[model samples]
Target: MAHKFPRISFFQRWSILFKCIFHYGMIFWYG
Candidate 1:
């Protein structure tokens, strides 16, 4: 699949980065 807009791709990457940061923060806090 291909994205139609570069902005959408950038947003997708940003969201993935945020998710990873959130996951690590949770693990650090509880583990």
Candidate 2:
């Protein structure tokens, strides 16, 4: 359980990071 927590948080952070990068790229390209 404890070990899984780190993996889950890592994935969550990665997903948020990807989302931010994707949004920033879109705005830079289209806005």
Candidate 3:
């Protein structure tokens, strides 16, 4: 599943990292 994406741009990579952080933060705060 993790290998399907093309890491061709810095913004895409940054956004993915940001999303992972945001999701973890939300779960930590709400769970």
Candidate 4:
């Protein structure tokens, strides 16, 4: 239970970061 917490948090943060990057990239490319 203790070890699983960090892994889940890391994945969540990574997903959020990736989404933001992708969004900006698309905006920059289209605009």
Best by TM-score: 4
Question: Sort by lDDT, best first: what order?
Answer: 2, 4, 1, 3
The TM-score obtained by model 4 is 0.82
- Candidate 4 structure lDDT: 0.93
- Return the TM-score for each candidate structure: 0.80, 0.79, 0.70, 0.82
- lDDT tens digits by residue: candidate 4, 1-31: 7566998988989999999999999999998
Tell me the TM-score of model 2: 0.79
Top-lDDT structure, candidate number: 2
Can you write out model 3's per-residue Cα lDDT over 1-31, one digit (the tens) per residue? 4556556566688999999999999999999
14 in model 4: Cα distance from truth in Å?
Answer: 0.5
lDDT of 4 at 18: 100
In model 2, the clashing pairs are none
After superposing candidate 4 on the true structure, give the runs of residues whose Cα lies further than 4 Å from its correct spot.
Answer: 1-4
Please give the CA lDDT of all the candidate structures.
Answer: 0.92, 0.94, 0.85, 0.93
Alpha carbon lDDT of residue 16, candidate 3? 94
What overall lDDT, based on C-alpha atoms, would model 3 receive against the true structure?
A: 0.85
